[model samples]
Target chain A: MSTVKITEEQLQLVEKLGLVFEGPGLQPAAARVAALLVVSDTLELTFDDIREILNLSKSATSNAINLLLNVHRIEYITKPGDRKRYFRSNLARWKNVMKEKFMDLEKTNSVLKEVVDQRTPATKEFNQSLEEMVSLMRFMNQQIPRLFKEWEKSKS
Target chain B: MSTVKITEEQLQLVEKLGLVFEGPGLQPAAARVAALLVVSDTLELTFDDIREILNLSKSATSNAINLLLNVHRIEYITKPGDRKRYFRSNLARWKNVMKEKFMDLEKTNSVLKEVVDQRTPATKEFNQSLEEMVSLMRFMNQQIPRLFKEWEKSKS
Candidate 1:
């Protein structure tokens, strides 16, 4: 067992991020688990350790952690010589989440573009507006990978 | 009054986007209103016109429209010789929405960096993880305006 203590401010930040994570379709408990993991002293915690700190029931903790793991937002590894599993935030996978979102945006943009293309030239103004949106989304998709590359360069 | 018709597919898209808008702090009615405006043939509709199409109560329409207007997600224009106001989606302002979200992400990154700094050197691995998130968000903030500019050029 690790001697980690969470401060009041840390707990408050965790609750706030818990809500932020909840915005992306995570359940309330799962979001809280993600938040707690992010704010934990070592940024990695065992199942029993998290449950004890969060005062969560075993079932609640299990369910929330499982959801997080399935989403690839969090991951676990077994410590050598120990039977316990340690979980931590999968920060590297956030780029994948951003890519997935932009892909969805691209899909929506294409659908909108198709809708615009089928319209008569008489609907010029509205078609132009829709076209602008498609252009914007396309620009974003083109640039996101470069942004990811920039981050990699910054780290090195 | 404009001769505008929404097709079944268009209406479905509007409904989907309405739910997406609802997730971003807009009330359900406001989100639906925003979605309808986006898919409208004229891209602009009068208050009475929208109320009729959406089958909303007068007060509900008023309340929802007011909320959207206050948030700068929608805007209205007055026609010459007309007392009636026409509302439309402020499509250009969506860039601002994306900017605001990135700013919030930057703030969260800063807070995490601060937390990482306070931890002991022994938590080097965890601090490095948090630093990478900060770097990624920082990179995004630097690139978003450039992306917006690229969209402008593409449109031209």
Candidate 2:
């Protein structure tokens, strides 16, 4: 009923990559589903295909798919005349992920600045270092846009 | 017996920061401990001070402290003639944390390259985009060292 064949090696890669996503707070099932989509041979996979391939429970598969879809980590399309939805990894938004990380750094810098402002002069050295840390973060946050531009320029 | 004091604002900041650290897989009590040391008035905190301030159980405080110490996220100092240990946030190692994150990006890129290599031609479009993602990652990985170097030069 299906043409998808996953090698043991591919299965191992899926778990390894899944752990990488899980490092950033993604749930285990959703992470595994995302990795499976990325490394699978088929361009797109239906819900049952994903569930069966990963040996996940029906609810687990549905929940994982929903979460991934909500986050835009994975996307789906419905084929002409087919009622089932096909899900696939959406690697195109990789730039947005990096930008969001940079934004988080900026937010952290502001928070630390407020912390620094609230500190006593007795913590002068630590405050100075923390300020420096914020400066460095600001510098890195600025670099992401430039880096993306460079990547884009090289592509064209 | 204690000179340290925490404001309502600082306490809120600690919880906010605990959530930030938790995003990267740090434990709750440990994250709170690390944030507490950063925003607290005192440079270093005793075990009892930490446990009381954060309202953590003895075992929770001990486990969190041990984990932060083991990871070098926090460090301890012992004053002469004092039997108690004084723990503080090791913000100086923040540079190393950023470096480790970049290293992680490099690791993920390599694993993704392997994914692209093993993928069938039917998924060519996704494969090429994945390759571009890897290339962009490699570029960013190279940028981190240069960013730090630029930062150091500016400092001196």
Top candidate when judged by DockQ against the true structure:
2
lDDT (0-100) at residue B150 of candidate 2?
89
Which regions of candidate 2 deviate over 4 angstroms? B1-3
lDDT of each: 0.77, 0.86
Cα lDDT of model 2 by residue, B62-117, tens digit: 99999999989999999999999999888889889877866888777888888888
Q: Model 1 Cα displacement at A94 (Å)?
A: 3.0
lDDT of 1 at A46: 90
* Chain A TM-score, each candidate: 0.85, 0.94
Docking class of 2: medium
Tens-digit lDDT string for candidate 1 (A74-139) = 999897899989999887787787667556656656656655665557767767776777777777
Q: Which segments of candidate 1 are over 4 A away from where they belong?
A: A1-4, A79-84, A118-120, B1-5, B80-83
Give the distance in Å from residue B86's predicted Cα in candidate 1 to where it truly belongs: 1.8
